[model samples]
Target: METTNEFERYQKAKKQVEDIKGFYGHLASYVLVMGLLIFINLRYTPQYLWFVWSMLGWGIGLFFHAMKVFNWFPFFNKEWEEKKIKQYMEEEKKTNKFE
Candidate 1:
């Protein structure tokens, strides 16, 4: 049982590492592609400067991806939500006892 649990944990950790690696890979690709787009836009249509649109759009997505990979928003994280739920339930129990 312990060995199985350990293996499960190891697998979970490995998966998480893979997810982080994938996010970084995505980020690298975004940078490379956006850089190329910017170069093309500047070389071909400097007056219009339309590459900013794609840059901003894809940048927002990459920001969210990075946030998810790094667990940046603590308030919305799963463990924090679970802890808050348990605390609220305990407080409700205490209040009911007093009532």
Candidate 2:
């Protein structure tokens, strides 16, 4: 049982680390690709800044990806969910005084 628990913990940690690494990899790729795209756009069309569209669109996605990986939204994270669940359960228990 102990070994199983240890193995599960190890797997969870590994998965979390991999997720963080993946997010960083995505961020690096975004920077490199967007940089190249901006360079190309400027070189070909100096007056039109169309690269901003792709950058903005992908930037929003990247922002959400970052939020998910980092758990930036406090109210929506696992801990918050657990707390809310417990709070609601306690409230329900209180309301069921007859039981």
Candidate 3:
């Protein structure tokens, strides 16, 4: 019984991690597509050195997307999601206790 409970916890944690990653990926995709459009516009216009800004924006947004997808960036490691979910659960427990 104890082992089953532990397994369930692990599964739940893993699922939460995937869910967070999926959510981040979806949002990042939207940002990336917009950045791509900005890049294209800058390339075409080349009026006021906007290309640099577009590239920077695209790079930063893509970098985060890569980090979330790969779970290898220094600040956003795989463990981050686990910690976040655990923290959320802890907060929920406290909130529930008060209510």
Tens-digit lDDT string for candidate 1 (1-99): 999999999998998899899999999999899999999999999999999999999999999988988889767777899999999999999999978
lDDT of 3 by residue, 10-93 (tens): 997897689677867767776777678777777787577665665677677766765656655765565777898899999999
TM-score of each: 0.76, 0.78, 0.39
lDDT of 1 at 50: 95
Runs of candidate 3 exceeding 4 Å displacement? 40-99
Best by lDDT: 2
Residues forming the 10-long window of minimal summed lDDT in candidate 2: 69-78
